[model samples]
Target: MERRIISAGFVQDALAALTRRGLDPAPALAAAGIASGNERVSNLQYGRMWLAITAMIEDEFFGLAARPMRPGSFNLLCQAVLHARTLEHALRRALSFLRVVLDDPAGELLQKDGLAEIVLTDRDRPRLAFAYRAYWLILMGVMCWLVGRRIPLMRVDFACAAPENRSDYHQFFGAPVHFDQPRSRLVFAAHYLSLTPIRSEKALQGFLRAAPANILIRYRHDQGLSARLRARLRATPPEDWPTLDRLAADLRLSPATLRRRLRAEGQSLSAIRDEIRQAQARIMLAEGRLKVAEIAARLGYAEPSAFHRAFLKWTGTSPAAYRTDKQG
Candidate 1:
């Protein structure tokens, strides 16, 4: 699967926040491998830039309406919730911790009518756009990490009026979103609250290192059958990939049924195969550990020319050119 990319508007927001505090964002942007003020950035670049900016300013919340969430506050927050018996307990504990740290805007988790609702409320009406985005993302990310599944959202309600980039929020939240509502809240199935936290301290050590990058992928297996199929393809080696008929058999469905299912999901077996192959090719090229011929063989391509053609088709450049661009 292709890695997610972030809109440059988010970086612009971060820059504005830094400028307000008399800080320079150029160095951080450079460190994050972004050379231009373009409209899109790879998710990895966004994560790097976000961490660098927050670290330089010593404020994890990026000086958004809330008090400066001091450096290391996120680690502390993660530690505080790591051992909860269930996601419900962990979520409440996390909200309580944030409330104590940032006072005015309080986080609440409520379960009623077979739905779990997570809300961020502020009687003082603090600057909410940035803060709300971060808080909701944090809550959803942490909850999903705890349960080892992407909890499908039913609806996301925002108290503030919709912004011009409202569609972006809908994409990120993966659900119906209502603006100009009485409160900012996320709604999902209540049963997720009962799922125990599957992460151990050891597991969390690696996860924390990845941080926001892990959370930003817009789609996950629970979102649809296509995502699940992509996950399966990703897990298997390219040389060992199953044929369409074999894959369908393994999935316990007929080839015709599988095709129909994938079509309904706006996907096809060939596209999924190509995505996985392209992703692998890029990774191998970026690593620079293998020659083009070797990489082609590993990807099950019978000839180097075929691999080169596919690479050009997928990336609009030759494999060698792509590698050189990435390495430089």
Candidate 2:
């Protein structure tokens, strides 16, 4: 399989954060084989690249402090958060506007009662393979810095069992860390919402709009495996219809292992394959050139009748009717 790249906007934010801390991020980036220059990075591509860079910087340079907050991005995000009308509104704005600052997969910020929470879901399975725990720490640290307060955290939650670093949680979050929970979360006092924003709306919007595409893509891609799998199917179609075994092999796992892993991730091979087929069939039908037989063959169906049945199941209409609907 081809290696995924990281978002340029995310890279820029990380670089900016590193620079603010008086550390040269170029070496870490170069160690990950990324360019230190300001070239645009596509959000649709570069997921692995960004993850690799993030891992490198966190392990080598930032360690526990490796979050967007260390750079000015978190402060900028806080400015937007401070400008909102209420704690709820502030968190909502932060969720909507802060995507450019961090390449986090779990991106929910919610407030209730007297507590505020930031929820992050790790999509990757085998629990600890991904560096989400480190990223979570970075997010909390940055948020604390942005509010300019050592805001006390109520608790921390994770889907996985406790790692060896359980002791460090208190130092970083200033709260207790809970493991074996349904999801990862950072709980805090609700009072942080009333603080005034230090940055102007115009400035915030400018930063969000001009954020590097690379980072945006990372956010989108990291959200789930279904999306990532669909993107892969589109980019590199096999010569024949790829079977579950084949696809799993390509992703570097046994068929049984893949099924188990996908199950853990709340997905199934059949669902993903059908999704890809339907998506491709729609695109082909829209082009209005290929005969039903050719489209069927391209999609790895051995017979046009089988393809037609599948199409009807997918769209609730036959292939011809679907095409007519699109053309009309």
Candidate 3:
């Protein structure tokens, strides 16, 4: 989660907006601890940069339009939706609240063909892909938080032209994304509408403190063995990573049975372990808070050279080279 795993396209888009507004993006980037020349920024860095930019412009919407969404608009919206009895009520109320505050991009919930769609419509200006991405992310994120799971997206449609990185859309929505559509919308199972909100006012406080960070990073706690395993791995320190046998025991399965289950799920324990380590390494390196040797040790590597070899194999670049390239 600490890694600079986000696509550089987002940063570029934000910078472009700053430039268009005749504002210097350097200060925001610096405040986020992001090197202006870097290709990508960590999620935390992006959140910081976003907050800084919004503060400077006094618009939480990032100057995507003429009218500014005041800085505390999101907080107010969350408060309004918090007392809803069901997910449907929460979304409908939240969207209604937003419509009153913002002049464009009003939202409506439509039900048809066993699917519930949250459609967002805006004044027909050339849309920034990043802006649309952010819009969809917030809506989907808040809904998921309410239902206590990652809602399986049935369809995601955008009004703008397809982005150059089309493949990324699939990963973002966990469903194929269609562009050049009539309006921006997210479709999912209608059943989710009746699901009660699992979050309470106490929980909302923590969510508000983190702001967009909790939403921007999509964490699926609902399905997928890979996601569950990834969550467990993330919760445990790299140095304390359990052995396959121990992991199986923890999951209440024999080692052989666990192996079979993993293979059936189209994954392997070793592969998942490697992924966790690589992700952690990338984040730590991006943060630049630890030395290479220190990171290697923290990741349970016996020697720095072993860590270097593993990193090179995983990333096709030496650790130092990867860090330098990403850090600019």
RMSD of candidate 1 to true structure, Å? 17.9
Candidate 1 stretches with Cα past 4 Å from truth are 1-4, 218-328
TM-score of each: 0.67, 0.35, 0.67
Candidate 1 collision pairs? none
Off by over 4 Å in 2: 1-90, 97-104, 124-130, 198-328
Count backbone clashes in candidate 3: 1
Q: lDDT per residue, candidate 1, 69-156, as tens digits?
A: 8878877888989999998899999999888876757889887534578887887654556567777766667767766656666688
For all candidates, the clash counts are 0, 12, 1
Relative to the true structure, candidate 2 has a C-alpha RMSD (angstroms) of 19.3
Instruction: Note the residue pairs that clash in candidate 3.
Output: 3-283
RMSD for each model, in Å, please?
Answer: 17.9, 19.3, 16.5
Model 3 per-residue lDDT tens digits across residues 1-328: 5766566777777667678889898998888888873476666788888888888888777777546788998888788888889988998988887678766777899985335788888867647666767666666667666656555565688888887854656566655578888888877656558778878999989888887766766432223565677679879888888888988888888999987866544457776677668767877888888999999999989999999998876656778877787688
lDDT of 1: 0.75
